[model samples]
Target: MNINKQKMIRNVLEQHSNGFYMQTQFVILHNRFFAGTHVHVMLKINNHFLVEHFKYIKLLQMILILELIVFKIAKDLIQYLKIK
Candidate 1:
């Protein structure tokens, strides 16, 4: 959600050995997930889909972990609580 994280995700995807399709899908999937309920999109993916997207999976893991940590640790939470 933040610029730094977005930039980092982009870097990871861009640097991947896979072709452009996966990277483009990565961006689309990320936008779709955060745009609404990511759980739903995740549920739609089967193991076959996972295998298809295997290369991006690790990067997705990193993005998800970073996202959770950011939401938990970022000062944006203070703004939400009007604590600033």
Candidate 2:
């Protein structure tokens, strides 16, 4: 995975709303998944796990989407600034 995407995923996994347990599990699960396969597999596994973790799936999905969107925007801004 690209470094930015990996960092974004790490950030998302680290995010906590209530306590440490949920975030810890998120990090561990992400680590286990990534350890076994490549980035493509990680994306597929993340999508599947999100489907199974339905309660907060919507929230997680939104966060992931926003993270990507922000990354794209940042990249664009950097390119624009560099062109000036």
Candidate 3:
């Protein structure tokens, strides 16, 4: 992947973690099955309120995080493959 693409993907993942929808989360995680990165770091100040304010949203965030991590890995892999 190009640097711009990597940046775009990272930005998307960050946003997904910050604000997530359940359906989107499912797609992300499913896509991750093809990635290598298994680590996702997200710091959200409102994360705790997610459960009280919206249970579904909280679950979606979790799913999104998983997917984002995988996506990050996949993006890196693509970049590596291109170089080779």
Go through the candidates in order and give each one's C-alpha lDDT. Answer: 0.40, 0.40, 0.40
Task: Give per-residue CA lDDT, model 3, range 1-84, as digits (tens).
Answer: 355644555565556553432223222222232243332333232122111121222334545545564555456657877999
TM-scores for all candidates: the values are 0.30, 0.34, 0.31
lDDT of 1 by residue, 1-84 (tens): 567756775676456423322323333335433444342212111111221122233556645643443334334446656963
Q: Compared to the true structure, candidate 1 yields what TM-score?
A: 0.30
Error of 3 at 23 (Å): 19
Clash pairs, model 3 backbone: 1-79
Off-target runs (Cα >4 Å) in candidate 3 are: 1-57
| Ranking of candidates on TM-score, top first | 2, 3, 1
lDDT, residue 75, model 3: 67
Candidate 2: C-alpha lDDT: 0.40
